[model samples]
Target: MSEITNFKGEAVTAKPENAADLEVEALIRSVGDRVRKARDLKGMPRRVVSELSGVSPRYLAQLEAGEGNISIGLLLRVAIALDLRIEWLVGGEDPWSSDVLRVADLFRSAPAGTREKVLELLSPEPPEAMRARRICLIGLRGAGKSTLGAMAGAKMGVPFVELNREIEDHSGMPVNEVMALYGQEGYRRLESQAVERVIAMHDTMILAVAGGIVADPDTYNLLLSRFHTIWVKASPDEHMSRVRAQGDTRPMAGNPEAMEQLKVILRSREALYERAHAQLDTSGRAPEESLERLLALIEDKGFLT
Candidate 1:
């Protein structure tokens, strides 16, 4: 069914075996071209990809040259290192230009609020029904989220959850140990999972989340969509004092400019925090006063209704 040039420079009808071999070779070449293009587009050097994937640079070169018959395990490593789906590397469609992939990339990078708006537009459920009386307290560490959340949940006769505590429970270790073992990115992944678990478990509850959650767009967006968020803020001085009062002096230990750093973090996150549905400033207030005010605010806003 196909013609081939013989060694004697004569055109001959290719046998079925030869045609199958040619098809295999063509597939190999196509895979190599895709790998090379993806590497170039990402600006990742062969050696860097090797380091990330634990595949040797020489093997990578051979694979990209269409000469290496790569094993599935090794290809999987490369795909993971490139932050790509394995199927994308071998699929017939051009992943970069595919409508589905392009839309997925755009949605991933969009802000949490924008993504929520898009989801709301697409979903049949109204925002109020999806949220379903879920209240989330978000602010910097020591802004009294956990303390106030527990008190408020008890007073309001609803369940209270601390996101980090849920993470710790799920991991079977302390939060500090989780941070030490997983680093920032790993911790954020666990944090996102914990948020999802809480959402799945409770439609009517109070939640206290980590301060840095806003730094993660996807997870924070998911939180905003599922919970009625309140920014529970206090002065930087109070933040430090409250943490110290809890016997955690790590924030100020041997750090002269700790307050300045806290202020900087707060300023950086101000815009993100402002996206919350409501705000409760606990600065210069007693626990009882803050609790009463939080209750009043929730009632006034009809958050549970």
Candidate 2:
């Protein structure tokens, strides 16, 4: 108190030294909230995630509420317990990560009229859109549907799946044996089941359907509703030639009038086949040529841009 001198200078104020520590605490709380939200979005209950990730439920809850300091190992375990990716816990801005935004960006940057054309290419028929777009190729046994479908699928970047082969796989028998054992009705039932399975499993594919599929109204309607049906058509003579070229003598087997029968079959199915969205004349044309025409029609109809 002697002289009451300002010994070192004016008194300095004590600043809030724990501000950064408080902010870190707040960040941990936010992280916990985000983790809970992600868990809810995945429709997973805490118990199931805990069992799957081998994390203790009590510890997980504590981590979620940010009531306890979680170690890095515990954080990872908690993230795994919640079936969450660690990157999601640590947030960042990525507007392009959304599917809708990405698609929008693609369309916006496209050349004039290109996006519309592409939409048309990918547009499904009203019925096809509602169910599954199962593009089934129906024709006489030798119309090159399988061959042309393979080529078309390669171009379209979709899997080329044969319905008959799938039936064989399911029945564990050769197609002819299955048909013989099941009769027409039995074969049809198997075919319908196979078609349903394929439609349920896949969203986009090229289906080489059995020729008899069109004969069954229910199956035919199902196909019409689900696929951009394209009939690969050819004259009876052409069909015979193509089949013979593939070394399949079954069409000509046991019937001297096989060609005539083929003509009749084609005549009966012409109207039915005409119901397709598009048709490609396979008569005299190479598979490549027919595929080009099909592609052109698909593009024109806005199937692919």
Best by TM-score: 1
In candidate 2, stretches whose alpha carbon ends up further than 4 angstroms from where it belongs are 1-125, 131-133
Candidate 1 to native Cα RMSD, angstroms:
12.6
Cα displacement (Å) at residue 119, model 2: 25
Top lDDT: which candidate number? Answer: 1
Model 1 reaches what TM-score against the true structure?
0.64
Residue 167 accuracy (lDDT) in model 2: 82
Residues 1-305, candidate 1, lDDT per residue (tens digit)? 44443334355664446777877667766777888888988899999889867778877776788666666667866875676666778889887776856776787678877788789887899887888999999999989999999999999899999998888876778998999999999999889877876776688999999999999989888888899999999999999999999999888889999999999999999999999999999999999999999999999998899
Cα-based lDDT at residue 202, candidate 2: 70
The superposed Cα distance between candidate 2 and the true structure at residue 67, in angstroms, equals 36
Give the poorly placed runs of model 1, Cα more than 4 Å off.
1-118
Residues 150-186 of candidate 2 have per-residue lDDT tens digits of 9888998978899999888766788899879988888
TM-score each candidate. 0.64, 0.57
**Clash tally for model 2:** 7
Question: Could you tell me the lDDT of residue 177 within candidate 2?
Answer: 96
